[model samples]
Target: MFELTRYDGRRRVRGSIALSVGLSALAAMVIWVYPSFEAEVDLDQLLAAYPDPILQVMGVQTMTSLGGFLSFELYTFGWVIMLGLYLAYSTAGTIADDVDRGRMDVLLSMPLSRRRLVAERFAAMAVPIVGANLLPPVVVFIGARLIDHPLAATDVLAVHLLSIPYLFACAGIGLLASVVFDRAAIAQRVALGVTFALFLSESLLTGTDAETVGSIAPMRYYDPNAVLLEGHYDLVGAGMLVAMTLAFLVASQLWFGRTDIH
Candidate 1:
C-alpha cells in the first residue's frame, strides 16, 4: 500500500547518511575549536560589538559556554538554516520533477489515488529529516565530552527531537511548491526563496512592529538556542510547526488533485 513511500524513502537513505556524516564532521570541528577560541578571544566583548539585530538573527544568546557556542555556531546555522533549506530543496523536486519528466502520467495510471501519492511521497521526506536529526546529537554529545565540555544528554536530544517538526514544516513548504509548479528547477528555486524569506522575516522582524507578519513563518517557532542553551524545549512551538506542516500538506494535496498534469 505504501510502495511509493518505501521506494522514495529507500532512495533517500544514502543521501541522508552523507548529510548526517557531513553535519557530524562540522559539529566535531566546531567542538574541537572551542577551547582555542575561548582562550584567544573575549566572547562577551566580541558579542557585544555585534548589533542586537545580528545577534538575534543568529540565535546567539551567549558564547561563553559550550552549549551556547554549539547552539550559535552549529544548530543555528547548520540545523536551522542549512538543513531546513536542504529539505525544502529536496522535497521541492519530488512531484515537480516527476511531472517535468513525464513520470507523473505513468504513476497516475497505477492504482494510487492522487491524495495517497502526495501523502506517501511527502511521508518519504521523513527519511532525511529523521536521519539528519538523529545522528547529530550523538556526535555533538560525544564531541563535547571529548573536549571536556560535557553537555546534558537530555538537552541535546531535545534539540534534535524538536527539530523534526521544524524540518517537516520546511518540507511542507517545498511540497506546496512542488505541486504548484511543473518544472522541478522552478519549484525548487521558489521553495528555497520562500523558505529563506520566511527565515529572514522571522529573524529580522521579531521585536519590530511587523513581528505579527513573521508569525506565519515556521522558523519563528523553532529556536535552537532555547533548547540547547536554556534547556527550554518549546513544545507549543513544535505543535504549531506540526499544524503548519499539515496545513501545507493538505493545501498541496488539494491543489495537485485538481490541477491538470499537462
Candidate 2:
C-alpha cells in the first residue's frame, strides 16, 4: 500500500508555496486599498435597490457605506469560490500525471492495490488543495491585523469555517472530473468550467431580485462580507454548503473506485 499521507504532505508544502504568495499579495492589496477612502457612489439609490430575499439566500447584510466596502471583501463570494477553484486547478493531476507518465503502471506492479493507489493519489491532491484554500484568508487576516483594522476575527473565522466545505466542494468537483476523464488536462478544464459556472450562477442570482435562483449555487450560501468582516454567522447557510460538499465527495469517491485506469 502506498503511504499516501506522507507523500501528500511533502508535495502539498512544496506546491502550496505559490498559493501562499498569490494570496498574500491579494490580502495585501485588499488591506492597502482599505485606507483609500471615498464616499460610496449613489448610496441612497444603491441602498434602495437592496432586495431582502436574495440577501437571505446569499447570507449578507445590505450596506451602502464606506464601512461596507471594507466588509465587501467578504461579501464577494466569487473570489472565495475562485480561490478554491484555483487550488483544484493546481491539484487535479496526481493520478493522471502518474498514469500519463507510466508511473502508475510500475507502481501497480508492486504490492499496492488499485484502490490503495487511488487513495494515496487523492490524499496527495487533498493536502495542497486544503493548504491553498486556507492560505489566503490567513494572509488577509494578518494583513488586517497589521493595519490595525482587523475586522471581526471571530466572525471571519466563522466564515472560514464555512469555507472549509466550499474547498472540499472544489476538490470533489476536481475528483469527479478526474474519474470521468482519462486525461489530466481535460479534468482540469472540467473542474475550472464547473467552478466558473457556479460563480456565474451566484452572480446572476444575486443580480436579480429572485431568491430562488441564488439558492441553487453553493457560493450563494456564503457572503464574505457578513461572515469574514461583519462578524455575522449563518448556520443554515453553512450547513447547505457542507451538505453539498459531502454529496460531491461521496459521489466522486465511488466513481473513482469503479474507474479502470490503464
Candidate 3:
C-alpha cells in the first residue's frame, strides 16, 4: 500500500534537496545584502515611487526593516511565485508523464487501483514541498544573526509553517491537470499557465468588485508579508487552503479512476 508512496517520494528526494539548497542560498544572499542596501537607499521613497497596485501585487508593504525587506524581495517572489509555479509544473507531469510513456498501463496492470495510484503519486509531492519550506528559514535565521539583524524567530517560523497548505494547494492544481490531460507536456503547460493566471488574477483583482473571483486562487490565502512583517497568521485561511487541496486531490482521484489508460 505504502510502497508506491515511498518509491515516488524517494525519487523526488534529490530534486527536493537541490531545490532546498538553491532557495537557502538565495535567502542567505538576500539577508547578507540587507544592511548595505538599506543604508544606501531610501526604502520609503523607493516604495512610494511604485504605484499602489504594483506594491499590492508584489506584497511590498515596507522595505525599511529586514523582515519587511525579506517579505517583499525574497518571500513574495521566491516563495509565493517561483516555488508555487515550480511545484505546479513538477506535479503537473506526475500522472501524465507516466501515461504518455506507456508506464501507466504497466502500473494499472499491477494490483494498484487507479484511485490509490493517483493518491500515492500526488502524496509524493510532499517531498519537494516540505523541502522547499524547511531549509530556507534555518538559512535566513543564521544569516540574520550573522548580519546583526534582529529578526524574530517566531515570525520566521510562522511564515514557513503557514506556507505548507498554500504550497499543497498549488500542487493540487497540477494534480488535477496531470489527470485531466493525456500528454505530459500539455498537462505541465496548462498547469503552469493556470497557476500563473491565478496569481495574476489574485494580485490584480484585489479590493475591486471582482475581488471575490480571486478567492479561488491559493495566493489569496497565504501572505508571507503579513506573517513576517506584522506577525499575522491567518489560521482560517490556511484551513481553507487545506480544504482546497483535498478538493483538488479528490477530484483528481475521481477523474483518473474514470480515465482510460489507452
lDDT of 2 by residue, 171-192 (tens): 6667667667777898788788
lDDT for residue 219 in candidate 3, whole number 0-100: 98
TM values, all candidates = 0.98, 0.75, 0.98
- Among these predictions, the greatest lDDT belongs to 1
Query: After aligning candidate 3 to the native by TM-score, how far in Å is the CA of 221 from where it should be?
Result: 0.9
Least lDDT summed over 10 consecutive residues: which range in candidate 3? 224-233
Error of 1 at 23 (Å): 0.4
Ranking by lDDT: 1, 3, 2
- The lDDT for every candidate, in the order shown, is 0.93, 0.63, 0.92
TM accuracy, model 1: 0.98
What is the lDDT for 65 in model 2?
Answer: 33
Question: Which is better, 2 or 3, measured by lDDT?
Answer: 3
Q: After aligning candidate 3 to the native by TM-score, how far in Å is the CA of 209 from where it should be?
A: 0.8
Task: Show model 1 residue runs off by greater than 4 Å.
Answer: none
- Expressed as tens digits, the lDDT of each residue in 94-150 for candidate 1 is 999999999999999999899999999999999999998777789899989998989
